[model samples]
Target: MAPRRCPCGTGLTYDGCCGRLHDGTATAGTAEQLMRSRYSAFAVGDPAYLLATWHSSTRPGRLELDPDVRWTGLEVLGTTGGSLLAAEGTVAFRASRLDDGVPGVQAEDSRFVREGGRWVYLDGVPLR
Candidate 1:
């Protein structure tokens, strides 16, 4: 069987794309990349990766992923800043999922920051 593509809409194999980031072998180079990997983390139910990539200043004491949510798709809407030399950035996207057979979508504009030389998720503001 062929490897599945990443949920981040990157058109690359999961192993070659977000999987590398999840496994600690690669770090996100951009805010969009971090957003993608974070989405992948949700899809795979890996809270450790999710928390690890979150900015400490905004990180919650604990994370509780909904096991009932089955992620289905990802669509990136836009991005700002988040370059290798930039300190802050934002990525807007829509993530679709199934909540116990009911379809739902999560649209948000996420913020990111570089802490200790690596990109990490800051927070998200809903797009509604």
Candidate 2:
């Protein structure tokens, strides 16, 4: 089968985008990239990857994605700072999901920080 399209909305195959990050062959180089990969993780139902990429500072003891919720798409609204050369950044995005056939959208402005040369999600504030 052809490689699946990335759920991150990058218009690239999974392997060429978030799959490499999910499978340990690559790391996101910027806050936006990291944000995209996180959305992919949720879309793919990999809560482990989500926790693994969370900043220790704000990471919770555990995370669980509702089994009924199926992520469908991601749309990055904007970003600032978090680059290979920057220590922190914020990404504003909206993600669509369907739970029990009920469609919904979640929007947030998420914070990210570079630690040990990798970007980790710190936290997020909901957006309207």
Please give the lDDT score at residue 109 for candidate 2: 100
What is the C-alpha lDDT profile of model 1 across 1-128, one tens digit per residue?
99999877789999999999999999998888999999999998999999999999999899999999999999999999998789999999999999999999999999999999999998999998
Q: How does model 1 fare in lDDT? A: 0.93
Global lDDT scores for all candidate models: 0.93, 0.93
- State the local distance difference test value for candidate 2: 0.93
Which ten-residue region of model 2 has the weakest summed lDDT?
75-84
Off by over 4 Å in 1: none
lDDT of 2 by residue, 1-128 (tens): 88889999989999899999999999999999999999999988888899999998888899988889999888899998987899999999999999888999999999999878899999999998
Q: After superposition, how far is residue 12 of candidate 2 from its true place, in Å?
A: 0.6
- Tell me the TM-score of each prediction against the true structure: 0.96, 0.96
**RMSD, candidate 1, Å:** 0.9
